[model samples]
Target: MTYSQERNKKMHSLLYKQRVLLEHTGKSSVFISNDSHKYYTNLLEYIEGDLERNIYTIPVLRKAIKTDSYEHLLKVVQFFSSNTSCLFDVKYCYELENMEYEDIQADEYTNYILYGTEPVTANGSEIEDFNPKYLSFYCIINMD
Candidate 1:
């Protein structure tokens, strides 16, 4: 597979596992709170230069939560699945080396190498690097 295709498949697998874990842990679904909305709004605005330029909007999230429909989040995930390169942090992409689709589906430890939510630190300091461009298109939709 091409680099982008491999990356996209790996990401899909990670998200699938995460959702399964969330389901088993009694969480009905991930919710986007007010703070999350604000954070994502800022991130999207920075990346896209304007949220208006994108198809997604802040109000859409508000409406989803109100109506108890997570279709918006699903759509975002679908977009991310296809545009993994746009949302992935290129700096850490080296970790993806040698990971095939089959291995990703079979390995329970894929999270540690991929999108692990737990903080990773170096020299007693936390490091954060989120891909801004298309991340605004998807992850903010979860923001739990």
Candidate 2:
């Protein structure tokens, strides 16, 4: 399948379900109260001008972590699944050096790492990387 086709499939499959969406593109989902929109928007706009846009968005992303719980984060992704703005693409973060997918699937200790994504996990040879921004969250705002 073409890239777009696969992307569409992934979005369709995940968005409809009560799950989180993370892709190889390093885009992930995040949810925040409507009141927090301004703050998030400003941060995103500022980071857009930075050379290391992804790296700098870490602070914003961290704030999101505190704002949305693991379960709610997944729900947010589902809410914006069809939102073209919220691709819910995840950014690369850390990885489980020695942990296997099967091992961590049920491990409560690795809950943070498994917050988002289904078929895609820190399992296999995937290196977990920091997903600093909610690309999908941008969809909720008007991009000038």
Candidate 3:
């Protein structure tokens, strides 16, 4: 598929996950069984990189947050998606699980977190401060 088509597919999937899929589970952290994982993992095979540089990751998280947290994730993803950028560390990342590339032969994968934050705006006003961050996404990514 062309780049535009690829991007649009990712957009549709992200929107489904953000609005439909997760809503069904009714939880922030949803676990997928190994069997189910197999089905969905390849769905994003056309995606360029892992969640590390994935564009869909942050937007979903931003929309998930009720207010302040939304601003931070948006800003961070925007910067990290680029070559070099940061805005007062509006985002942060910690790998709850780690898998290596080589080890992935048997069981390994690339899961990198690039964090930074954006401003939470209210009526064109952006909130800038030390706001607590929350988990907005639990994605199954294949970092190619």
lDDT of each: 0.33, 0.36, 0.33
Give residue 23's lDDT in candidate 1 (0 to 100). 39
Model 1: per-residue lDDT, tens digit, 31-95?
33443343323333343332222233334433422333345444333333333313321111112
Over 4 Å off in model 3, which ranges? Answer: 27-66, 69-144
How does each model score on TM-score?
0.25, 0.29, 0.25
lDDT of 3 at 30: 31
In model 1, the runs with Cα more than 4 Å from the true position are 27-144
Please give the lDDT score at residue 68 for candidate 3.
42
Best by lDDT: 2
Q: Of the pair 1 and 2, which is ahead by lDDT?
A: 2
Residue lDDT tens for model 3, 48-137: 223233434444434432224543444333332222211112223222225211111101111212333432322333333423343233
- lDDT of candidate 3? 0.33
User: What lDDT, from 0 to 1, does candidate 1 have?
Assistant: 0.33
> Which lDDT value does model 1 have at 129?
51
